[model samples]
Target: MSNITVCSHPIIQQKISSLRSTSNTARDVRELVDSITRLMLHTVTADLELTPTAQEQTSPVAAYTGLEISTKLALIPILRSGLAMLNAASDLLHTAEIRHLGLFREETTLQPVEYYNKLPRTCSVDQCLVLDPMIATGGTAEAAIQILQHWGVKRIKFVAICVSRRGIDVLAAKYPDVEFFVGVIDEVLDRRGFVSPGIGDCGDRLNNTA
Candidate 1:
């Protein structure tokens, strides 16, 4: 398994830094997160395969062709805060299918339990990317990937705004074949399973708390 590649772009770092500031208002943070998510999507999807298609002009003298994605792609958001990132990914990948999975951490146990799940009728897509803002304990992400794999998603990508080292390590050991992309890899997970230095509870920040 490969390590989660933390985006090192200067612009991404600037936006992330803004998002992390305690002084940032909820609205500001929300916008920053969305922007960062869109930028991150670009980096993550850079390697996607595309097929060329020819275009005919009115003059019929000039040949023009554009590339279209070769493989089907799906985006599965793990719920609440994950839904926050979902919107950005959808805006960027307008043609990609969207799936939803609800997994919330049990406050006391820090274990994730699913409250809802809705997937596309088929998962034979060439690539399916799981979108979630945070991956701290790995429970939610692990469970999410299990569901996708069961649906026959052969190639999977995990995208998150931030991840705790322990969480990344756990996912690598458990799902070695899947690829992970993260904006930042935090130094540690706190006792409550929250990533230290992470932008507080993402769902809370997004006003999606239950």
Candidate 2:
């Protein structure tokens, strides 16, 4: 089962289209990426658990629900490009706790391993959102989810700007309960481990690298 949810908003699609073009300047590309991330976050955080709080107003009393509880959701960024999307997801789910995990693609086999890990100590988390800009071969994502599972996270969701079919398949096969939220699903990975038709290197695009 391919459990990926691709955002279909016109604004998101338009901004992503701009990101796809090679002619876009670094500034424009960065801004488009930020815009697309914000939109994607809106869709991803729609059903977030919230706790109701009442406040007195001069006219009438009203209540609003803030993100239910601290342990309700955890945001884990897979480092580098994932850090870009992590900021947007954090902006949307302000109350959601953040756990930083740094994973890198090995030069030889592209397998992911932990360079840094700071998962939360609490084990009552209801859901966790993993942020990675590109899921080319599923190596990093699989390892990240596996780590989360070890830490007692029951529900997991992955958010990425683009993903390859093979990557999605690999993840689903490893962890069927995890859901993926992507902006676009692209073609195969190139020989260099980059997604074809992908927005160059997402980290480089966001950071204006050469």
Candidate 3:
């Protein structure tokens, strides 16, 4: 729990509330998700290594140093629904590289199954952010963190629009160093392994498969 930070910014809170509405259309849900993701990235990455970068430039009036971000950043968005956050995050951190991971859950076992993995053989980011719309069981998150670790990433953070307390505990017990930036924490999972009081199947809604 020490590593978890639930954003309380008013705009983030409002968008999250709108995002979870069952009556929301596909476009509305995607827009809300992207909006919250951008806001969350801004709020959470405020303290990232600035590096105090400056480049000398000749201005019309005088010579001055222009500032820039030198920290190496990467994003790993867990497939389909997670892809919704990728563009927003990219817009926030324009220099950050992106990687994709695909995992689907087994309805019967209620566990994650990795169907696609395209992580680079070597990653050189100072920090990596993993994006997922919902974390219900944490199995998918566990896999993502372990993969990043195996690739020699030093710092990793998991960001989600909604998380279940059970899922948070599961990830906390295993990877205390990995931070979590979440919009809201729902209580528990429903009978079907989905988070209770959650916006129904984010992937389905976003892709209009429902």
- Number of colliding residue pairs in each model: 0, 1, 0
lDDT of 3 by residue, 74-171 (tens): 88999989999999999988899998888888889977888888877988789999999999988888988888899999999899989998988889
Clashing pairs in 3: none
Question: What is candidate 1's lDDT per residue for 29-102, written digit by digit as tens?
Answer: 67887888999988889888888866643446765666778778888888788877878988878888888899
> What do the candidate models score in CA lDDT, each in turn?
0.83, 0.80, 0.87
Best by lDDT: 3
Candidate 3 achieves a global lDDT of: 0.87
> Residue 126 of candidate 1: its Cα lDDT?
84
Which candidate would rank higher by lDDT, 1 or 3?
3
Q: What is the per-residue lDDT of model 2 for residues 60-124, given as tens digits with 9 covering 90 to 100?
A: 56544432433477888887777777667777778778888989988688888789998757566
Per-model TM against the reference: 0.92, 0.87, 0.94
Model 3, residue 203: displacement in angstroms?
Answer: 0.3
Per-residue error (Å), model 3, residue 99: 0.7
TM-score: model 1 vs. ground truth: 0.92
Q: What is residue 138's positional error in candidate 3, in angstroms?
A: 0.8
